[model samples]
Target: MRSERPFSVFVDEFDAFASPAFATFLNKGRSSDFMIHLAHQTLSDLNRVSPDFMGQIMGNMNVRYIFRQDSQPDLGKPAKTR
Candidate 1:
């Protein structure tokens, strides 16, 4: 099944539901008029799948927003050094 008009899909808790096919769609969806919005709590959630897949997801994302998070690593902060 497919839509004739452009469409969008919102996937929340993306890491819990992501698959190799999603990686493919992220790479190819734009031209096909498909937009996918993925939301997750942390990169660690995606990393649990595979670092390579996580990299794929991050690389394909054109926009990202980081809300308040407790972990410094999630905010791309370097760990404190003495």
Candidate 2:
């Protein structure tokens, strides 16, 4: 069965953390498809969120690979490190 509690929490937190453009992008998609799309987009651009928050989101999703700098040289090095 689906858990509304976690999903609700996710929506609230997402709205708080995501940019207006990113949120708009997510809302335009189908609900069933949005999470998958969001996950993909988020993985592709982890810098969109704070590292601590990103870690929390990934942990909640049990995500293994949220796109890495090693995978995409175009993203450049970690901002904080520079």
Candidate 3:
């Protein structure tokens, strides 16, 4: 059973708010009609949180939209960060 009205959560500067528990929810929330929209300036934002955080997000997200950036690294390729 599910609610007729779906629920949605949008977080700006998601890197500041990311957590392992939340990342887990991203995988399980779909069945309950939960939707999440996250925004961040760069992948580095994720790297600052955890080494594998970026991969966790990119893997779960259904769609991605990248805006114009000063340095556009090849998103298809993995890049190391300090």
Best by TM-score: 3
Total residue pair clashes for candidate 1: 0
When 2 and 3 are scored with lDDT, the better candidate is 3
Location of the lowest summed lDDT over 10 successive residues in candidate 3: 73-82
- C-alpha TM-score for every candidate: 0.76, 0.29, 0.77
Clash count per candidate = 0, 0, 0
TM-score, prediction 2? 0.29
* Cα error of candidate 2 at position 31, Å: 20
Better of 1 and 2 by TM-score: 1
Flag clash pairs in model 1: none
**Which is better, 1 or 3, measured by TM-score?**
3
Q: State the lDDT of candidate 3 residue by residue for 3-78, as single tens digits.
A: 8989898999898888877788888878878798999887777766677877787778776777745545545433
Error (Å) of candidate 2 at residue 42 is: 4.9
lDDT, candidate 2, equals 0.40
Provide the lDDT at 26 for model 3.
87
